[model samples]
Target chain A: MQDLLYFVQQLINGLTIGSTYALIAIGYTMVYGIIGMINFAHGEIYMIGAYTALIAITGLTALGIVWLPLILVVALLCAMIVSSSMGWAVERVAYRPVRGKHRLIPLISAIGMSIFLQNYVHLAQGSRNIGFPALIEGGFRFGAEDSFQTSITYMQITIFATTLVCMTILSLFISRSRIGRACRAVSQDLGMANLLGIDTNRIISATFVIGAALAAVAGLLLGMYYGSIDPLFGFIAGLKAFTAAVLGGIGSIPGAMLGGLILGVAESMTSGYLSGEYKDVVSFGLLILILLFKPTGLLGKPEVEKI
Target chain B: MSTPVKKLVTAIATSIAVMGAGHATAEIKIGIAGPMTGPVAQYGDMQFSGARMAIERINADGGVMGEELVGVEYDDVCDPKQAVTIANTMVNDGVRFVVGHLCSSSTQPASDIYEDEGILMVTPASTSPEITERGYELVFRTIGLDSMQGPVAANYLISQDPESVAVIHDKQQYGEGIATAVRDTLEEGGVEVAMFEGITAGAKDFSSLVTKLRQADVDYVYYGGYHPELGLILRQARQAELDTIFMGPEGVGNKDINTIAGEAAEGLLVTLPPSFDEKEENQELVQAFEEKGEDPSGPFVLTSYTAVQLIADGIEAAESTDPFEVAEALREGTFQTPIGTVEYDSKGDMESFEFVVYEWHSDGSKTPVN
Candidate 1:
């Protein structure tokens, strides 16, 4: 019973973190889906999102707004706006100019942009890790008082709820909305869509904007959950989310979500049962195995060679 | 050229020559290097502020040996590579004395360069014993080693007579080294160490680690890392209802931990350098810091100030600006500073340094535990 409870606790822990990974992974997938290039600056966009949310929260609190829901809503909106604009600007300045060039060109440009944004934030906010106030606290505990107990905090619940709502809206947006249909057309074939009277550039920009907005949501959620923020926070997270995107199938939205959850669970389980030192090794090793065995991710479609 | 314009040029040339000669004799450049822009820059701020204050005060008191002390600052970002680069820059810039390179990893490598390049360095906060163990004649510190602090923490835990203790670290040089030291001492003291583990430094989630702690059923946990990770762990452990007592070294002693951990920060046991800022003798110095709106209570601040003071005193005692002679004088001479009486061994480590266990409160205040 104790072992089972412990396993359940690990699962809960994994799912909470995994869901956030999914949120960031969507950005990578959507960008790749439309443009066929990795937006390396996406992580910086997420970091900016976190910073914006933090600034909003701090400002609102200073203004004597003690209401939690209002604070979260405003912060989330502000983060989304800022991150979306950043994403749009990055695509315009870094990616669009070299759209038809060698893939490595945009990749290099993205790397440069990432460095620029990291330094920009570093200079603006002194390199100290500012502690984010733990606004939501307490949780439900399971099992007997003396035995091993499984615990879930209100913050974790908030993460799950927010991810679910975001995912639902994203799914609906992709499937039913007119702009969503236009996005699919552009992703299918940019030149063909352009010839068919769809505004390919606008669709591409919209994809970046939407992806960035979701990443912002993740940033705000993870920032609050972690209780701290720093300029370089996005680098490692970007790498992890990139891994998730590849593991899920680069251009598939559902694949990114699945890959993220699997990655998160793998990491937590490694930390729980084995050791935290081995968690990264295990997660990456899992990625290598998946790449070897499946080639395409679990939900990813095999690409057909162009004639 | 006209006769009057030629005379004007001659006058300007004479003043330039005079200024150049004055520069050679008027100041001794003390290189201040540390993480000016990185994650650990908070500690660097303390180091810079303290050293700068010492230089300002020393200059106001008619300068050192009738020559002004000029601090040439460099940023290492607390990275070993950056530290080495900064050390080389200091060498090329003709600096003979240095006051920093804060993290143990960065300090060790930078000190190696300083030792080889005939430069004297007194680190205010790097505590890894390996730093001084190299027997470098030029490398010194104003802080206690992890070897000293680990034993202090272990002895305290042993006194509490806990059933089991778990030791954890962030797997960096400083964190892992201190954790290993604590683990060794606890084992020697016949205490049961339920687990010794390492966590990724910047990773936010520690749920799995917290769950493992619960399963280990340890009554005490000693974390060897900076405040950010420990703060998160403290809050998570509290949320998980794990009521085990938590302890850490001075790295976890930052007041920002209060904001991160909130109420969970209360009751944290931290082994830190005795609060020199609170001492009655330091009241005036404390007032000086307050006037500038700077908090002098940070562990590194007074230690860094002492490092600068020792450098000045060493130069005076040796009666020479040569780094080698100053190094010799520092090893042999005893000087009074804000922290305490400073006397260095041949290895350039202080003969005696004190670490006190303090209980940290949620309001970002700490009271020494008797």
Candidate 2:
């Protein structure tokens, strides 16, 4: 009975972490969906978002801005703006030059951008982990001495809710907005979209900006949730989010969400059921298995390659 | 008359050259090896800082044996392979006294090179018992061995009267060795050993282990690992609502743990060296840290500062700039430090002091407890 409760708890923890992964994975999937290239620097964009939020909060606190909600709003906005701009700049400077050269070339360039951005942050931040203020204190406990209990803190709930809202907004934009249609058209066939009078460049840049903005939101929440931020934080998170994107079926919006949640839950469950040390190993191992068995992911549709 | 003039000139030139050689002999060089980058950089930084502080303080007070001390900082990256490279570099640089090689795996290999090079190495924080027990004469440590620390933790748990204890390790030398030591000691004390297991390091999930612990109805869990894994464990455990008290060695005494675990880290107990900052005798040093706008409670700030002093004291006692002479004096000498009176045994390990338990406060400070 106790073992069952422990397993259930582990499952919940996995889901919580999976939800965060899902949030970041969505950005990766959406950008990949539209551009047919993995935004390797997307993780650093998330890092910058975290740093931006950190600076904003520190600045506000320094100015004696005691209102918590207002500080969060300002920080979130700042993170999104900075990350979006970074995405736009990366597209212009790195990706644009290598556009249409070869898929591998752009991918390599993205990797280079990733390293550059990581080192840039490292040098700027002195390679130290900076602490963020806790948005919530204490936890809600549900059980007595003999009872199995789980506590839901505000930050965990906020992370879950924020991801949901961001995904909803993204879905609405992709399905309803004019730019969204253009993004989808480009994803399906960039040449066709261009031939049909769509501004391919503008659509591509917008997709990056939007994806980066969402990533920034995830970064901010992560920093707040973990109460620490580091330059290298993006690397692992980025890798995990990428895994989540792939797991959910890369290029499928809902697939990314499902993948993220699954990855998080899987990780949490692994940590709880096994030793915390094998959590990453278990998740990544699962990813490899899924890829071998289902190349397109659980939710992703198999793409028909053009002859 | 010509022969006399030539002899006088040659004598004068030879004397000047001899004096220059004498001047060179007036300085001693020691190697400070540890991770100056990567996740464990803080340890290396502290070692460097402590060595620097001691060097400055010693120099300001007219240096050791009336000669100045110079330190060469090397990055080991906490890897044994890198440690070997660093050890080779230090030996090539003629640095006979070394202060570090932070992790056990790194220190174990580096010590071999140091021993082979006839260099005297004193680790400020490496606590694996095998470190000194290997019977290497040139190697030493200022901190208590895992033998001492493991028993301390085990005793603490026994005192708490927990019905059962779960022991887990990161499977690394340091983690596994200490975990085994603790397990053996606890079992000898008639404590029930609920589970003994090994886990991979740098893993992100701990749910299965938590479930196992919950199922076993273990009253306490003692993890033999560093902060990263510990942080995730605390967070995930809390998420799974396993509310058992988690304990570990000094490896958990990192500010990063608090950040990574967030609120879940609160009330976590860890065993570490006694509070060096809270020592009334360290008031002046504490004041110095405050002057620099640095927190004295940081993991190795005090230890690092003290390492420098130890070198200075060794140099002073030797009354010579020769590495062999200074090392000899170090082995024979004792010095008061912010941490406490530090005296190395024949093998270079600290002669005294026991590990003390501390509880991690929410504000990222550790308070020493009985």
Candidate 3:
């Protein structure tokens, strides 16, 4: 019974972290869907978002905004603005210049941009982990007097709710809005969308913008949850998010979400029941296993073979 | 023009010969080796600052053994392979004494090369006992070893009388070595180690570990890692409301922990060597560092400072510039330094190194607990 409670508790912990991974993976999936190239610098954009929130929170606190909720909101807004600008700048500078080149060329440029951005942040911010002020603190505890107690913090709730609302709004916007339709059209048939008077360039930029905004949200939530961040944070996080995208089916939105949750739960359960040393092994192993059997992620549709 | 050029060349050659002769009799080079650049560079920088200050004072006071002491710096970058390359380069470059290779992993490997090549090494920060236990005569340290520190930390935790404890390490040499020591001592002291585990050093998410720690109902979390991981664990555990007293080794003794953990860093306990800044007699030294905008409170600054002091004192006592002779002087003699009277046993480990537990305050300063 104690072990069962621990497992259930780990499931919640997994879901919380998975939700953050899903948020970043969405950006990877969306950018990949439209451009057919991986935006490797997307993780750096998330890192920038974290720094943005850190600076904003620090500045706001100096301005006497001690209220936790207000500081969080302001920091979140600042991160979105800064991160969206970074996303737009990266696409315009790195991707747009290499559009007509080979597919691998743009991917290489993305990786270069990722490295450049990481060092840029490292120089601007000192190489120490900046402690973020805790926005959401205590949590609800569960279990009876005889059983072992488990907890889910309010910060975890905030992370889950924010990711859910953003994903929902984003899914709805993609399905119902004209811009979303144009984005879908470009993903499906770029030339057809262009012929239909859709500005493909603008739509592509919009995809990056939307993806970056969501990633900014993820960065802010992660900073608040972890209470510390570093510039080099992008590499490992980006790798994991990329794995989450691949596991959910590259370029699939719901698949990214499913993959992230599965990855998170696998890690939490492994650390909880087995040894914590195998957390990464468990998550990555699950990814390889899923790709082996499903070929497309759990929710990802099989790609149609071209003639 | 040819006749004048010949004269100029001859004059330059004459001065060079004179300077070479002066150099032969006037100076000795000690390499301050560590990661001068990389993620752990701040630690290297602290070591650099301490050693540099010691050299300035030593050189200012006429020379050690009547010859000026010169410090040559080498960047090992905390990689054992890089450390090996640096070690070989130092020996090749005529550096007979070294004061670094700060990380235990780097120190342990480089000690072998230093021993093989007959170069003397005195590490200021590396504390894994295995570095000395390897029984290299040329290798020595001014800081307390994990063997002493782990049991010191364990005794402190046992004094708290927690029902159970969780022992975690970052799986790195220094972290795990110290943590295992604590675990061994705790078990020997009749305390329960509810859980013992390892976590990846730089893993950003620790909610999973937090959950397990909570489920285990451990009242004390004794971690063996640096500030970054400890900071995250404190914040995450606080978020989970699984409030347990979090303690770590000297690696967690840094201002970084406060910044990384925010207000949750308050009251964090760590076992560290007695801070030099807290020494009443070292007030002037601490003030000198503060006046220069360098913090003197870092874990290794005093010890690193003391390493150079040991070198200078050894030269004076041995009355010889020979590396082997100076190493013998260090192992045999006691010398007064900033960290107090230092003496090394036959194994070149500190003879009676003392450690104390400190509590980190929210003001970003830590005070040794009474």
* TM-scores for every candidate against the unseen true structure: 0.95, 0.83, 0.90
lDDT of 2 by residue, B1-370 (tens): 6999999999999999999987875667878888887666766676777777667667778867767778788988787899999899888898878888788989998999888878878788788888888777777677788888999999999998888899999998899988999899889988899888887765544546665666677888999978877887787577556788989998878777877787888889899887788889988877876776766775566776676677667767877655567677878877877878877777777877678899887668877777
Tell me the spans in candidate 1 whose CA falls farther than 4 Å from its real position: B1-24
Error of 2 at B4 (Å): 46
Fnat computed for model 1: 0.80
The candidates, ranked best first by lDDT, are 1, 3, 2
lDDT of 3 by residue, A184-245 (tens): 99998788889999999999999999989989999999988887788888778888898899
Give me the runs in candidate 3 sitting further than 4 Å from their true place: A1-4, A67-69, A100-103, A145-147, A191-197, B1-27, B35-42, B65-67, B72-96, B112-119, B278-284, B290-293, B316-322, B366-370
Candidate 3 has which clashing residue pairs, if any?
A: none
Q: What tens digits encode model 1's per-residue C-alpha lDDT throughout B213-298?
A: 99889989999988888989998788778889999999999887887788999999999999999899999998988898998999
Task: State the lDDT at B217 in candidate 3.
Answer: 80
In angstroms, how far off is B156's CA in candidate 1? 0.4
lDDT of 2 by residue, A100-171 (tens): 888999999999999999989877876656667766555565555675554566666787788888889889
Candidate 1 is scored at a TM of 0.95
Q: Model 3 — interface RMS deviation?
A: 1.6
Residue A34's lDDT within candidate 3 is 82
Clashes of each: 0, 25, 0
